[model samples]
Target: MEKERKVFGISWNVFLLGLVSFLNDMSSEMIAPIVPAYLTEVLKVGKLAGGSIMGLIESASSLFKVVFGYFSDRFRKRKVFVFTGYALSTVAKGALAFTQGWLDFLALRLLDRTGKGIRTAPRDALIAESSNGKTGKSFGFHRMMDTLGAVAGPLIAVLLLGLLSYLPKEVLYRRIFLISAVPGIISLIIIALFVKDRGGEVKKKIAGVSSLRSRSLQLFLAVVALGTLGRYSYAFTLWKAEELGYTVLQGSAFYALFNLIYALSAYPIGVYSDRVSKKALIGAGFLLSALASICFAFAQSLPLLVVAFILYGLHMAVMDTVPRAYMAELAGEGEKGTVIGAYHTVVGVFAFPASLIAGYLWNTYSLTYSFLFASAMAFLAFILLQFD
Candidate 1:
């Protein structure tokens, strides 16, 4: 009898990439939970300005995702862009300690997200190429580790705050920002030392990203764009928690809960996606997103907010992992990077107005209107995907 090759169902390189992501998220998440408060309280920025900053950051990320993704495919280079991206982010994270105003915050924040946009599609292409038939399994495993880091990042923040309670808040915040560089540096070393340039495996298609001309990609990107149009910044979630009377520490706890459930469920659902239909999983994700919107819309208490967070994590697991895998499966040879980049860029472009719209709704109508709008969009997306 032949022995089956089974070890997390990913290449050794993919596994190392996952480790890199895990460390990076750990560094990033350490900053994420504190961003809203840091901007509004310490920097004296308003909530609307904060939301706008997030919107610009999202836009920056999208812009870079398409730009670098195409070039990576055009030049048939992956590791170099991936390395530069992470290195830039490491510098940006460390630079946070020196930010003087909202302008500084905006510039540094955009720089950080730019790095993300550059690395994401190429890294995902690398994983998709590596995952083969077990696309979900590979993505699930990566996200599981990424989410695990997310779980730790906020908790680490809370712990650091508690331990350093005696220090001035400004000093403490700067210290945490400085500390984020450690994990980021570790990630850079791993990528530099271990991750190889596997771009040679991909055949260079015609010179540009004409691969997006395919009808299937057109439909997929449209549906996802429409579906994700309402999915706004998760910073809104933390904002909502604060509105509901949870302290910053408690909000971190809620975020941690969300990541915990996400980490635990991501891999199992990813493995299950391999056995079932990817479209079905994607559709289910849309509906779950709708459901979570409703829950967040109606949630009145912290405990109820916890329920919303849990559903939110589940929605991410079902939707986020499957669609990319599906798209990767759909791509022609050597086109994964471009297609994935275009797909992400499209969804992100549509999502550009999300936080702005959410902020507008919150300021003009109410949070309820924002949530309802999101729920309606998600439901519509799910219905459309079902038709596909």
Candidate 2:
């Protein structure tokens, strides 16, 4: 495998695509850390509805990613889908400036995620194709760039809000949304100019029912679904910060910190996964994540909560890079995009219900209970992987 596979190397396409993701994540995270606050405080959507909305958008993206990726595989075209998806996200962010109600917000969220769904698999496919055989390093580099953007977006948001805003609360958020468009434009240009697709002749036929049949992939998807149930979101971390009386600026700062750590760890963890068992790393990630969630739940002071958030970032670094690499490893060569899309779709299918359950538990019971529930789900995912 080592001789046949390139090691510690990547191509120009990979670097360019990573820049595209970097810019896109910068645009996306600019708004993400603040969306819950905007929905809850401005739109008055309530916690459960907000969680449901967030989860629904995510699930919707996964659905589209799967569908588009399947078609892209059949058609052997990836660039158009990638371009169109980023365009859609850019439009969505533009619309956020004028959104006045929950309906508009919902529409914008769906549209934004629609772009995500369309682009994710193709973008990933492009990276994998570029690397040929070093799947771990390829995906890891992409994730690192993506998380670097994640770190920058919040910092940008914080800076803009701090320096340029003296307006009312609503206006301030609107201005932040407007500024998000800058990264979107940057991403569009970077992708259009630099990203390339070299995957050979596409089959041009829909996968028959048999193409979707992979028992190992199915088992892994189930495990991932269970893991996602325990993984509510980092948004909740911001929410908890607010509950602890952290200002929005403070929350954004923490958000940036988390992403910083997450960005730094992505490549190392990916490389490490190649050295060890991917499943073992995933289990370790989940277990550490559970501990972080539990700690977040019981934390009463700002310092402890900050610690939990930092650890949560580490958890994400492991989760985001390794599992996808594992999935790629599990997939047959030509079937990578299909497998990636299917994996995301399956986990996303579970995300909808998981968010609903977590929201209900958070609202009806307590936030602590919600964290505990998330922790339990992580443990379950860890346990299920033993058989794999």
Candidate 3:
């Protein structure tokens, strides 16, 4: 038997996967913080339309996860899907520089998300396979590395915007979008050279969705579905900053701060999740999300908004990291990818209506109403979790 390599006490595959996510997230976040402003201010789209677009884009990205995940498991090949997904996203993101209208932008964004949907479940299955029983620790470390890119990406955008202050806003944003593709390209190279496929073992029958009979997983899925309805796009947070009179550069800085907190907290939370109850941690995260939404609803100043973003970051860390470990643990060995894909699909499907409802509330009513709706849903999710 060949000896497996370890990095930072986790499998080499896990560490490399984290590095891939770090670079990819850096590429994605560089453009993410500014996208809402670009759509609303530059493209002259309405807030409701912008919100719907973002939600649609996000949901589209995850909708394909289940199909691709099943294919990966069925063929017992993980690396091919992973590589193809990254490649598609890289092309889509780079093509953003050429889009002149919202329709074209939406097309490219969908392609990018399709890539994400293709890769997510299989990549997560890779992480689970590589964890060697340290599921929580592995996922947590991956989240930490991934978020560090999230932290760096916005700061980089801030710096670029400052440097290109003399250019027209449209040109500057386009240039940043072009430059963002570099990290993604680098990630692809790493994936091609380093990421290994561990799904070579022959199984007599690959498990399908019907095999996901675990009661705990079903309850977890329901809780995630309910919670997702309240989880609006991050654009709303940036929009709130704009409403409070902060510049885009300042908003990016604030986003970087949120990612910093998430990065710092994720690993410890992941490690603790191994020792404690993942359900309780996820419930606590939901509660924090509810409180954060309430704060966003009432925040009138930058400081209050900062506090809200901090809480949001903490909750994101828990919701994003612990759930993967929990789901991996819940799944049987032959069905990890399918089960995780199902979980992601549920979140994605619910996110569509969630974002639409949030947009309606923000458009027809007020931002406060939208946030209050989010808080109410999150609180309900937290309460429902108790039944599990």
- Candidate 3 stretches with Cα past 4 Å from truth are 202-205
Best candidate, lDDT: 3
For each candidate, what is the lDDT?
A: 0.83, 0.81, 0.89
Candidate 2 per-residue C-alpha lDDT over 142-238 given as tens digits, one digit per residue, 9 for 90 to 100: 8998999999999988887788668888888998898888889988887788666665543334445343587766777778888888777566788
Per-residue lDDT tens digits for candidate 1, residues 1-388, read: 1222345557777788889988998999888888888888889977667777777777778877877877877777888888889988989988999998989988998899889899988998888766656888998898888888898898998898889879888888889999998999999999999887666776646454566887766887888988877787878888888888887778888888888888898888888888999888888898988888888899997667888999899988777688777877877667778788887888778776877787788878777777888889999988887766
Cα error, residue 163 of model 2, in Å, equals: 1.2
Between candidates 2 and 3, the lDDT winner: 3
TM-score of 1: 0.95
Q: In model 2, where do residues sit more than 4 Å from their true spots?
A: 1-8, 201-212
Output the number of the TM-score-best candidate.
3
Question: Model 3 clash pairs?
Answer: none
Error of 3 at 189 (Å): 0.6
- lDDT at residue 105 of model 2 (Cα atoms): 90
Clashes of each: 0, 0, 0
Ranking by lDDT: 3, 1, 2
